[model samples]
Target: MTATATEPSRGLAARDDRVATRPLAARLLSRPEVGSLIAAIVIFLLFMAAAEPFRNVANVGTILYGASTIGIMAVPVALLMIGGEFDLSAGVAVTTSGLSASLLAWNFGLNVWVGILLALAVSVAIGAFNGWLLLKTGLPSFLVTLGTFFILQGVNLGVTRLLTGNVASADISDMDGFASAQNIFGSEVTLGPVTLKITVLYWVLLTVIAAYVLLRTRVGNWVFAVGGDAAAARAVGVPVRATKIGLFMAVGFCAWLSGMHLLFQFNTVQSGEGVGKEFIFIIAAVIGGCLLTGGYGSVVGASLGALIFGMTQLGINYAGWNPDWFRTFLGVMLLLATLVNMYVKRRADLR
Candidate 1:
């Protein structure tokens, strides 16, 4: 009887040991986002300590507002990166979507809502075309997206000049449905002493949804498999083409949403706007732990990366530094984060 009782106790202790160690082991294996999270915290504290205005409630809202716009796109871009692809056109696509809406409504006398819907369709179709061409041509995504980026950029400029006789879209603030759209995309909410833009809510919603899809779904598993090894994933019956196409479309969808916010908030969009923002999106993703080689990253990490960007951008201004140095700071952060991510990934691989 004593021997049997001890046997059960031993088994129970073993089970408990596994239960305790499982999460730690999993965390060790999933260390890509760890570095970014730490970086974000460190940067936040650094800014707070050095810049008094950075700690103000209103300023906190400003930081988040800036973060939201970038974070909104970064989430989907991170997922696309995890799926082993790039969307270089993503930035200009925002302009395309906004221009589509603004020009469609202003020039054609269509309702603002109608223009918005048309823009959504056009953006999604553009993304689908990119994915389709990538698969059909067996071309590098960077090259394929670069082509689309230029095409869209040219269209944005050429068509805006042709239609508006100007480099910017006509103001749509007085159009039907403008007010409602603004309320959805550009409105602000006051919470106690802080006012927050609606974009923050959109950013949070997208992040949460993306995290769920990445962590808790079969499709998410397919994303990892495809990114890690597309051939192997295909051999195992993953829908590789469909997944890639879907990811591009996801980027397109995000671009459209962001464009809508831009249009509604300002009631106009520069035809040349969003030209270089794609690099920012990719940089944010890279800083968040998404590998250039694909197959490893985190949505939360990307969000944190965007948070770092917002804080740094505004923090510099609060510190009375030259705005031109922001790009220099981004380059430094990119290099440092890449090194840290590589080290973390190496350690994880060794284990």
Candidate 2:
């Protein structure tokens, strides 16, 4: 009787894999951000040794500030990709937000806040439209957002010239709400040896919030589910549609924040300023351990990717090297990070 009972218990234990605890190394390897974290450290060491200015404490703030501009959008873009979508219009969308606020407030003699509010609405609506059209037509988001990208690019240029009689938005520094907007969006904060842009704070805040929602909430589960397999997620009663739409709207909201910062920080915005930035955001997401095929990524990883970008950008300039190779370095990192992510995933699965 004892032998029989023991055999049954042994069978159950063998079948129940959770009865065994995974090693700490295996657990860390399973995390999506591990590879990127490793890479970030290596890159930091490389720059720290190679460039003197890159080692300056104040330059840390500069690098963080640069990373923040990209991180602010990259975090949302990372989430959207985790939910299985793209937003090519994201680049021009920033310009659109700034231009919208600048022209609306200047031409109509309204408070800049009014323009800012309206710009937010318009940006969110654009994101909603993208999501709606993708769902209704059963089209890939790539094609949908690509179309949006072109439309917004043309509209940014055409509308800016038509309204402002120039290729840039009017300086709104003298307008009402400009001071508060500057304080909110473009302000700098100093902590001892470091001066940080407000966007950097927002970037960190967004990353923390996004990390919480992704790891700790039901909505986070839905995002992974939809990205892994939308039909399966829907079958499981997950609100796949709403999740994707909300993700896009998040991207839109962050874009508006970035746009406002541009408008206030420079006192004006170039109509063409954001034309190629979408690629940088996407690259940051990919490097941060987000896969090209979706369903796997981390917001923190994306931030690290942005940090790598900022470091390389400033590191090159500081080292007195040709900055032209910046994009080339990014392309290489993207390829390598993709390979590393795939290997890491396989290793995690094996573990």
Global lDDT of each model? 0.91, 0.91
Q: Write the per-residue lDDT of candidate 2 for residues 1-351, one digit (tens) a residue.
A: 999889998889987767778889888888778888998999899989999999899889999999999999999999999888999989889999999989999999999999999999988988998898899899999999999999999999999999888999888899998999889888998998999989999999999999999999999999999998999999989998899889889989998999999898998988988888999999999889898777889999999999888888999999899998987898899899899888877776675
Score residue 46 of candidate 2 by CA lDDT: 91
Residues 1-351, candidate 1, lDDT per residue (tens digit)?
Answer: 999889998888887744556558566545788878888989889988988898888777889999999999999999999999999999999999999999999999988999999999999999999999999999999999999999999999999999989999999999998898889878999998788999999999999999999999999998888899999999999999999999999999999999999998899999999988998898899899899888988888899899989999999899787989999999998999888888888876754
| lDDT measured at residue 256 in model 1 versus the true structure, 0 to 100 | 96
Candidate 1 least-lDDT 10 residues: 17-26
Please list the residue runs of candidate 2 whose C-alpha ends up more than 4 Å from where it truly belongs after superposition.
1-16
Alpha-carbon RMSD, each predicted model: 3.2, 1.6
Residue pairs in candidate 2 whose N, alpha carbon or C atoms collide under 3 angstroms: none
lDDT of 2 at 149: 92
Candidate 2 contains a number of clashing pairs equal to: 0
